[model samples]
Target: MNRSPRFRTSRTLACAAALLCGAQGLSAQSTAPAAPTAGGDAPATAVLPPVQVRGHYDNDIGTSDAASEGAVTQRLIQNRPALRPGEILEFVPGMIVTQHSGNGKANQYFLRGFNLDHGTDFATFVDGMPVNMVTHAHGQGYTDLGFLIPELVRRIDYRKGPYFAREGDFASAGSARLALLDTLPRPLAEITLGQRDYRRGLFAGSTQLGESGVSLLGAVEAQTHNGPWKVPEDQRKFNGWLRATQRDGNSDRALTFMAYDARWTSTDQIPAALVENGTLDRFGSLDPSDGGRSRRISLSGSTRTTLNDGAWQASAYAVSSKLNLFSNFTYFLDDPVNGDQFEQAERRRMFGGELSRVWDVTLGGREHAFTLGLQARHDRLDPVGLYRNRARDRLATTVEAEVKQTQAGVYGEWNARWTPWLRSIAGLRADAARFDVDSSVAGNSGKASDEQLSPKLGLVFGPWQQTEFFVNAGRGFHSNDARGTTARFSPDGTESLDPVPGLAASRGTELGLRTVIVPGLQSSFAVWRLDLDSELVYIGDAGTTEPSGASRRSGVEWNNHWVLDDVGLPGWLLDLDLAASRARFRDAPSGSDRVPGSVDRVASFGIGYAPEGGRWFGHFQVRHFGPRDLVEDGSEQSSATTLAYLRGGWRPTASLTLAIDVFNLFDREASDIDYFYDSRPIQGGPAAEDRHFHPVEPRTLRVTASYRF
Candidate 1:
């Protein structure tokens, strides 16, 4: 149910006040780390002291199944400086997050040599609830992380490739699972101010109920910003969360509610020629009216029961979301009189549930384990549509439709420790989906169904000298838009369109190594390859993704984390990640084999000093994304991008802290993202092919102050 704006405001304020009051007189304490669920075979959770102390990752050496799988603790997360909530994903090695539009929208993502536009091919979850939306108005698997409150995130578990049975759709490239903290060590309030009129406020607290094993947590956040663009972004956002958890003798359960609302004016990409010839400023907009508004509210619950040497977990969630987006990518290409501006809108309601059980047994003096899981989801979209617009007013309807989609999947896996130094994992998964669409055009109304089966395997060798080797192979799939699977007419109803396949398949293989051979150092490396039956590309102008030719991508990644304490420099940590890949169409001619927008190299380095019981802490980091092919023939290429950030803070007391952050420390002029395409920047002018880019913001600073009771 949707609440009135006034109601939302009142509730937000009430929650904020309640959180502050609940935190009074409560002594601060360190939060205990929880064990990972057996469904994923995750390792134990470990961390250093949490009172403003940073810790290096120490969970992947012998307890992990793959070199590319690991967990990031909250301490590391808190130490990092993130300009936007989505940037938190950067903690995943070799992943790059950028933005081409407003900060309130989903950020663009790149990984494994593929430009995963707005989260395609990557599955993301928050507290067991899937973040990727299928049959979305903007694109398939559109994931928006703006609603996330960075301070509430506890841990991020990530794995690369499609070698795990627990991961389902959109897992071909990788997956990231964000876990929210059940409680905070202390009730806290924070405020921040920055350049470009940026301002934010946050309040959060947790308390236990009397004599019962029940606890409650509440948080609220508000933010506003006017970016450095000629046309101010004028963004406003509000978020709220409430959760209650209970611990029984052998079972743990929790229920959570989350709400988010935001609106912003976008500074979309501009034509390169315009900026080069001084026709437009680097931070300028061709259409100032382009913007969007979004709203989402969700309720979810989860339960877990721990048995002797085994576990059972189950979760259910329901979400209601709406989006009204206006964009003008091609200034005047479609209609010279009214311009090419248009709107994509949708109102969606979705619900899903998951069940899994894991059990261990000893047979013939050998240890063996088995896992079984079931998953199902349904989505109902009312009045999902597209329309031509001049400014923000609709001029003509392109297409309007209602859709119902349902999907279900089941998986089973067997793990065996055949020898003291060897193990094997094998799994199989089957999924099916049905889509029904009611369209404004008769030819586009129909029903379609499809299914897929995937098999997976993994082998692990000896952990000789604190090092382990792994080999994995698997198949994964991503679902297409429900409308695309049955449509026979284009959005304009002027041309006949052939329906695309409902599901696209992918196969992946990897050889990996993980080691802690060097004291204070944890390292992992992987060489992997992925082959897609059909490549998916997002079409910005059309607000949808299209299936392209088959393609292949191969890459290698190296990740390292070091705690300087072993080297006699306590409280210092260093990290480095490097990746390089090659991507091409499988059947294309030699000259045209290159995949457009495929990144070839990426790297990041960071050093942080936050000694235990220290009064001062600091962190500095740098990231680089190598140039990429902007066109199929490789004639056009994008420029490499490099950025630096710094953060320094002082703790004046046990309950008070202040920090300052500097972004783009070098003030470098670079593009956040680039596209080579045809556009008409002027009315009645011929469309010309040129590079379009979104420039990065200039060097900016932010100051934050926080207090705990």
Candidate 2:
């Protein structure tokens, strides 16, 4: 949609003004500190402890006017076993993470019935810094979480749907915010060894910097692996992190720096014909030279302070990254001599910031809350290109271009308690973006801009028996690749093409309930629907855009968490989650309702036994991914797959621990991902349409030893 520059500027300024005014008003009403208690006025300069929230839920369900929002604490992260760091996202309930290429590449994400192809519609953030890349060389929203150091993550806050005003682009399906710990409880050193030549080492620790109440923490990790592929993945990675934090009674501030680098050879997906004919194994590859290399460095800071009856928070970050990838999807289809191999490369720098204020006020004996937030981001990518290559040597260039993108957004929300049992939340958000591209092809260089305004509403009723009912509706959007909005010709400049819109809109509605009536059990159920204005997708492989018809999706999700201690089964926990959905092209012709690559069902179950101060702990978990349509006409489909994991640990002393993990516990033979497409084999024959797949890793065992000083 088109928006006037004057209107966009005014709205942003107005939101900023509101936030400042709220902060000022709260500060003016601050009360004097009370006299210190006990011995000698408690050392006049002592720092106050940070505020803490307790329990399995962050919000007081049935009382707070929120739905589908929850937090996963460090306790859960430490007790679970994940084959890859990206699997940590599985804690988001109903969301699934899988891989189609190699360990160093971004994980394929599926949620809310949408394939989400590498984070297209689901937003992700770490410590207030955006993780999704716009107009990327590989994909529009390519997000790689392999750099994350799981041990340093303090909590993960997640919300599904588009009901929160504070969230912007790429959040139509959902969003996740991860926060890291500013300090470690003690110095730690760990070593891990496993089958398949797997090895890893990690070191992390924190200590006081001086007498200024400031603490410093640092971490370093190095790992190598030759996965289950017959060609050997040969993956190597390195990561480092450092942070300094200061805290004083309900207030905290921190500065953090992170660096990561990785390189690996990928096996890619193998053709069904070859596997069935015994020409190649499931874990074999057509081109062993296919692989990728990537690196990222970032610095960020955040602070929060109390203001009378309210609080204010602010954060800023800067990042630089680079990627180079090689692949041969269609072995000999297009170029029989060169074998259709190509390379995608890009170098980028990004900066962003966010500010927000929250306060509570009483009106007519009823309490109300207000929140205002503002965000801004910019990206510069130079010489992003697509090139034809043979064994990593470039033969020809299809497209070479530079892109500069910027976005600004503002939002405000209000929560009111109409009565003891009724509450409502209303909000509005506005966002604007500008895209500029400079291409080697003369006529393809251009500039474009777009903006949007969205409104949100939610109503809640309940607490009669510790159950809450909610109804929510909102408008959300995801931005298109900047290159797509300005391109006038194909990558080779041989044919003319229409420029796609800069932003696509989506609308969603949800009806849900959350309950805690069973003492130690917490459960939630939600039925939701979403409609997209358009499905214009960026073809990363072709360096162009493809227009698809609009689509609609509806789904149901049920999640449960139970602590068995209250039920006479002490030191036990059980968790179960399930999701089912239907997705189709809106108003499509007969026999064309299916939305390709959309999954129809997903489920997960876990059981764990760990007692407080216990010497031994164990956990068992399973994940199931159901069938999916591979094409719009439903001419092809994929089979279901299930995998289990087991973990057992022993704490020999307060400062030492040992653990063992078994992945793919049952040694199941299944595909991690599957696609139906046309591709020629290395033997050089006519193009054949068949299923391509990457098989899941076989059963493997890993052991770890840790010591804390």
Candidate 3:
């Protein structure tokens, strides 16, 4: 790596000037004020202004329907070291985020024994807007968070089961909602530089509207990186955000706009034999042309009003996005002439809205709460297709189609407190969807419709000793890709295929406990099980639906958060989370029940120290992903992986801070993801079966500086 003396000097001077100005401001504020006089100015006495505390408690253990519901606040997000924006989801216990391709693509997510390919069973949202793309070209329920500006996040609320009436679709495994701050305490500008030619810049600010009860917030970000690959990644990205909020008494409304664009070259997974035989280095690529480009623009608005008894809320959003992905998974295997390269492309527009009302009442001397909600969404995708390509030129069109999808859902829930230590929640939801696809191949064009009714129930007992026990059960479902729902033939229109169900149902149950009995400690334990009606999915790569037997998964999770204020180490925090699970095909033969790629164990630990009025802060964290069977018969398995990270910061003044982050701190050699497959590297050669993997990045360091105005 080379250094730019001019850039370094400018940054240093800016930080120094900001710190100097901040110190002078602090000194002026510390000066004594005029004394207060009471009644005729007799013996005036100095009176200090009253201090107002501002900050909310972190919800490490939530008091909701399920023990798995919790929240991560800005305090934690600001202190953690994340190699990529999507890693923020790691705040969800037992959740692992890893990338198998380029930074521009959606990271692979695993949780509770489910691989959740590209956010399939796990739903994600940002500021009332959904991030998951339905009927996506790459995969169903595809989610990308690269557009997120982490500094704007206020909090992330997460729940690990489908036990709530407010959640629907792709939420069977879990859901996460990220909220952005409506205002900032001050304007800030930050610059970060790291190994492998990585650079990023961020600018954000907020201001009040004069006497209008309104506020405006704006942010912009630019980033570039050339990863340590045989062929440079050359990732470039830009993001922008704007929000306007109006507040009046107990009511508030906000309108937000966001935009993001990114382009990058990728190094897809490689054959293990190639690396083992020294034919290619771990950082080598099978195809240098593998890459992708994506963009998203959205506008959303939300409003809340306090009603006579409870509250009313509503939100709506519209988004437009485009994606062009090029991948070469098995070179010379499928198409020897074209080298097996393929492209997936799509252009889509989506609109959605949600409305809800909550009412509070007392019945028979007991308090009760009720909520009613409705949600609707629509997606119109044009020219979604798959094609064979050589280099970057398309050689043949496999499947090309236009799709329209619409969904409507409604639900109602009631919560009742029967006794001081007993509570119950019951809910029911109904959803209906319609899918229409017009394919370039006439035989595959068709329409399909489906509906489902889901019931939910939860019971809570005891707060005795600051511990609560919970029992929850719920039914949920995820919509299949529109193409899968209406397809009559394969991509080439040669082989006939049966259309899959429009919606696949899942049911789950859990028993859990949460405790805050120990001082400065919050902990939770949960044992859960889920069953899917069928393991059927639309394979984007092959452009067809594949059906499998029913499946079941059982898991246990334990999460703990402890603060060490009483141990003479104020502002020190520790977090530990562990999870284990078993996934099996319910209908499989006795000797082959194991589900492929289902991880059995996961763990994460973190420790941080950030004392009040101190000039320094530091954090260290470790994450582990245990091995798992690679096939239904359990003949092959993957090896476990562990990685560590360290972050430290020095606040020279109230308005200036410098930070450094070390990733893969121990220089561990590991794989981000792995799969077992057969491929032919040479024309007319016998196919070889082996484990394919994407190696994780080696040790890297990043330094950042921030100035506040």
Q: TM-score for each prediction?
A: 0.93, 0.93, 0.91
How many clashing residue pairs appear in each of the predictions shown? 0, 1, 0
lDDT of 2: 0.80
Candidate 1 backbone collisions, by pair = none
lDDT of 1 by residue, 1-709 (tens): 1112222222332333343231111101101011122123111122223334334464555556677878787788888899999999999999999999998788999999989988889999887778998888887889899989988887787878888887888999999888777777678899999999999999999888998977888999999999899999999999999977777887777778999999999999999999999989999999999999999999877776677867777777789999998988889877889998889899999977676677777789877778777677789999788888999999988778899987777788878878867888888987777778898877888887777788998887878998889999999988888888777777667777777676789999999998889888889999999999987543435734365799999999999988888888888999999999999999899999998888999999999989888888989999999998998899999999999999999999988889999999999999999999888998887899999999999999999998888
lDDT of 3 by residue, 1-709 (tens): 0112222322332333333231101000000011110000001011111111111125433345678877776777888889999999999999999999999999999999998889989989887778888899998889899999987777777888878777788999998888778887778899999999999999999888899977888999999999889999999999999988877877767778999999999999899998999988999987889999999999887776666776666677789999999998888888766688899999999977676666777889887778777667789999899988888689998888999988777788887888888888888988777788998876888877777789999888887788889999999988889898878888777888888877789999999998988877788999999999887788878777887778999999998888878666687888899999999999999769998888899999998877766788889999999987888898988889899999988989888889999999999999999899888766676678889989989999999998888
Model 2: residues with Cα > 4 Å off, grouped in runs: 1-66
lDDT of 2 at 240: 97
Residues 1-709 of candidate 2 have per-residue lDDT tens digits of 3334434543564555444332211111111111000000000111211111123334345423345667676677778789999998998888899999989989999999999988989998887778888998888888899889887777777878888787788999988887777777678899999999999999998889778888888999999999889889999999999987887787767778999999999989889889999999888899988999999999887777777756677777789999999988889988988888889999999977777776777779877777777877789999788889999999998888899988888788777778777777888988888888998766878888888888998887876798888899999999999888888898777889888888899999999898988967788889999999888888878888898878999999998888788888777888899999999999798588898888899999998877777888888999998988988899898888899999999888888889999999999998888899999987467899999888899999999898888
Order of candidate numbers by lDDT, starting with the best: 1, 3, 2
Clashing pairs in 2: 48-249
Candidate 2, residue 684: lDDT: 65
